[model samples]
Target: MTVPASTAPPQDEVSPDALQAATTPQSPARRRGADTRALTQVLFGQLKELEPGTPEHSRVRAALIEANLPLVRYAAARFRSRNEPMEDVVQVGTIGLI
Candidate 1:
C-alpha cells in the first residue's frame, strides 16, 4: 500500500548529509513524493556519498541520522513495547539502513 504524502516527511526536509547514501538509480518519478521508497532513495543517495573519514562528513552524517531518528522512533512506537527496551525500539527502527 502507498503511504500518503502528508503523513510522510518531505524529502527536502531530510538533511543533505543523509541524502548522500549510495543507492540504486531512480527516475524522477520515484523521487516525487514522501513514500517509504522515496525516503529510501534519499537515504541511500546520502550514504553513498558520505565520506566516512572526514570530520565534516561525519558531522553531517550524524546530523542527518539524528534528524531521521524521530521518524524511526515513530514507526517503532506502532508495535506494543512488550517489555522491549527503548534501545531495542530504536534499533528496530533503524532498519532503514538503506
Candidate 2:
C-alpha cells in the first residue's frame, strides 16, 4: 500500500530556520512538512553507509520509521471508523512501514 506524499510542505513554503533545523541531526517532532523532507534525506543518506542486520543499520531504520510516522498516521486516519480503532490502524500502518 502506498502512502500519499501530502504530509510534506511545498518546497517554496520552507523557511530558512526550517531548512537549518532539517540540516542538523535532531528530533523533528515539532516541525512538520519541510522538516520531514529534510530528515528523510538525511536518514536515507545514513542508510547508504550501514550494512543491513547491523545495530547501526537498525538504528537508522528506526529513525526512518520515526521520521515517516506522520505519514502512517495520516494514512491510517483515512480508514478510521466506528468499527476500526485509530490506534489499531496506526499500529498496522506502522508495521507496514517497517
Candidate 3:
C-alpha cells in the first residue's frame, strides 16, 4: 500500500533536532508503552476517518502494522525454545497481528 503525498509533512519543515530526537533511545518501558498507546489511538482515529480501499486507508493500516511489530517479535520470542526457526515464529505472530 502506498502512502498518500498529502499525509507527509514538507521536508523543509522537519528540523534536524526533531529527526535526532525521533531516532534517539526512548526512556523506560512504561513511558514507551504510553507513547505507543497514544500513537495507536491517533492512527486508529485517522483510519476511522478515511474511506476503505483507498490509499490513505491502506497507509494507515500499514502504519498500524508497523507500529505494533515489536509486540509480534516479543510474542515470538516465547517460542524460541521450541526448536523452530525464529523467522517462522515471527511470521506467524505477524500474521496473527494482521
Candidate 4:
C-alpha cells in the first residue's frame, strides 16, 4: 500500500498519464478488523515508558489512531441524520482519537 515518493515525476515534467492517476479517487484499503484489536493492545502494552512526548511515542500514538479510524467513522455515521457533513464528522472524530 506504500506508494514510493521517488516514483512521482517532478512538477515540471507534467505527464498526462501521471496526472490522471494522481487525480483519481482511490478506494481506501480494507481495514484489518480482527487483527486491529490485538495489535492495538500490543501497542498500548509497549507504552509503559515515561516518554509520552517523544517521536517514538508519537509514532505509536499515530499508529493507534490509524488502527482505530473505522471506529471513529462508525461513530460519525450515527450523526448522519444531522445537518453536518459526514466527512466533517469523521474528521472531528479522528481528532478526538488523539
Residue lDDT tens for model 2, 27-76: 46545777888999999999999999999999999999988998999899
C-alpha-based local distance difference test score of model 4: 0.84
Q: Model 1, range 18-91, lDDT digits (tens) per residue?
A: 56654545666444434544565665677678777887666656655665676777777876546888778779
**Model 1 CA deviation exceeding 4 Å by range:** 1-50, 81-87, 94-98
> Candidate 2 lDDT (Cα, whole model)?
0.87
Q: List the residue pairs that clash in candidate 4.
A: none
Cα deviation at 52, candidate 4, in Å, is 1.6
Comparison by TM-score, 1 against 2, better one? 2
Best of the two (1, 2) by lDDT: 2
- Angstrom error of the Cα, residue 36, model 1: value is 13
- Cα error, residue 20 of model 2, in Å, equals 21
Of 3 and 4, which scores higher on TM-score? 3
All candidates: TM-score = 0.40, 0.61, 0.65, 0.60
Tens digit of per-residue lDDT, candidate 3, span 17-46: 999988997779767778778999999999
Off by over 4 Å in 2: 1-31
Q: Report lDDT per candidate.
A: 0.65, 0.87, 0.91, 0.84
Count residue pairs with overlapping backbones in model 3. Answer: 0
Error of 3 at 54 (Å): 1.0
Q: Please report the candidate that would top TM-score against the real structure.
A: 3
Better of 2 and 4 by lDDT: 2
